[model samples]
Target: MSTPSATPATPAARQSLTMVCATMAGAIPMMTLVLWFVLAVDGIGEFPESWPLLVVLAAAVGAYSICELVGFRTPPLQYSNRPTAEVQADSWRRFTASTFTRFAVCEAVFLISVTLAFVADSFWVVLLGAVIALPLFFWEAWPGERNQRRFAAALESGGIPSYLTGRAQD
Candidate 1:
């Protein structure tokens, strides 16, 4: 697809898709955080034997938060109020940043949560939560390598043409 960074002269379709993906990048993490909290509250497993899983959980969640924060704070996306393609590009950049920063933040949050659970003896919630949640996380995150290709193909196919045609009327 024609990513905004594909080249400045890239078709508006590519740029537009890039923007949508970027916005998605920011949006997903916010949702993940909510789900993570829910899972934490529910207790899928214990943190003692499940430290590794907790780490994974925290990292994934943090990635989402970091991505959202970065996207929300993005220079370009925040630059204008139009809510269009350029915003997408800027927002996508946050998603990219999330790919790295998310791990750190997620880990930190998990550790804190685990500690709090332990100190407060809120064991069942976190332990059971981890047990039930890990598999789901793996499966949910598994589309790792396929995301970009799938999105690119989705965009390159017919999205742009339709969008442009619709926009032309305005």
Candidate 2:
């Protein structure tokens, strides 16, 4: 495994991945907000338990932490040593899949809160979920430079070429 040296990504690759991240980041919040609005207006029903709120908040934090620690780390596979285009493609697939999984987990936290809002007839639950999830969505799911570098380093350590992650050798 090679250590990834920090380098600028190719402009085209950077733009393409950036577009992917942008679209995903935009679509997720949009979907979550739309669902929340529909339920807030017409779907909430009163339920008398508040414990679920704490449970949901705890679950959100736990889930995000687990995903952060585990999802981004891909082990070196036998095929990773090949250094072929197929390897690059596989690396890209893994990277994108991990990205989507992280995003989905974050979105799930908010969606769960939204569901709780409908069940408990409490908008505060939704707000709490957003408070936990939105910052994570930005810090982890948004394909900012820091995240791009992190993923690049991970992939590089797993034997993928840095170019696939829009990085060059130092």
Candidate 3:
């Protein structure tokens, strides 16, 4: 027994959401650049401690794989029997929540990389981490119109009506 909100998501809300995601996604590359600059100017001289950086790199690879699984796929809940409005609201809620989670995880990847680069006095860590992360940041984390369409279609196929998918009206 769920009561759907009478007011659906407004276009303004959709635009705001997209902008927020895009802004955060855009920041990642800039942060990577900053790391590169720091390493270029006053890099810590190389140390023989390679084991710790290797361990962190391995963890980063694992984290990237997990992030991919968690970021893009929505939980397949049975909402076909529910009212379209209720289903739409639920879908919207899930989509928005997951978008933020994906963004956070992606940011974590960059953070881990940048932090390791500083600790290890190596620029390569940031580069490798950015390589693993930037694709997903642009592809999955950014809530562009294309992503919205895909998400809406996925939900529609799962039993939510196309109209009730809460996409921003053109």
Candidate 4:
């Protein structure tokens, strides 16, 4: 019987992944613009407001940290006795899902900051949140070569390959 051959992920799939990363990164600038517009129209209204807003900001940051920590530590896809292609596809799917989740968390934090800025009319507060969140977003959501290799290795039978040295398996 002829065995099914494994193949690298298609170019289209890679492009789609790239687009997803780009979209996630774009959230930062988008939020910044929205904040600016709101501030320009409304002006900074008040400062040293209630403790609840501060609590919400802290909670948002904490939630973001937790999501990033969990996403990095956990493998979205577990090894299974299955066809190579199936495993590869599943691995990529999991990688995408995890990445999206992380990005969403980052986006949520940004949105919350913007909302707080709008409601409190305090630029400094949102700026502080953005300062904290932007780095976390870049660190956690930016998909680099290392991330690609990690995702690819998850599809390997042994799951020991930390990096792909050559053409990816089909």
Which prediction has more favorable TM-score, 2 or 3? 2
Q: What's model 4's TM-score?
A: 0.65
Residue-wise C-alpha lDDT for candidate 3, range 1-170, written one tens digit per residue: 99988865555546777788778777877887877778755563344266645755676566667656655566454645777556656766777887788777766777787788877777777776777677766766667666666666555665535442354333
Q: Kindly report which residue stretches of model 1 are placed more than 4 angstroms away from their true locations once superposed.
A: 1-66, 69-98, 128-170
Question: For all candidates, what are the clash counts?
Answer: 18, 0, 0, 4
TM-score of model 2 vs. true structure: 0.70
- What number of backbone clashes does candidate 2 have, counting pairs of residues 3 or more apart or in separate chains? 0
**What does candidate 2's lDDT look like per residue over 98-163, in tens digits?**
777788877788778877777777666776777777777777776666676677677677453655
Q: Global lDDT for candidate 4?
A: 0.61
Ranking of predictions according to TM-score:
2, 4, 3, 1
Candidates 1 and 2: which is better by lDDT? 2
Best by TM-score: 2
Candidates' C-alpha lDDT: 0.40, 0.67, 0.66, 0.61
Q: Give the distance in Å from residue 55's predicted Cα in candidate 4 to where it truly belongs.
A: 4.4
Q: Could you estimate the TM-score for every candidate?
A: 0.28, 0.70, 0.63, 0.65
True-vs-predicted CA distance for residue 112, candidate 1, Å: 1.8
Off by over 4 Å in 4: 1-11, 41-57, 73-81, 149-170
Worst 10 residues of 2 by lDDT: 161-170
Q: Roughly what TM-score does model 3 have, to 2 decimal places? A: 0.63
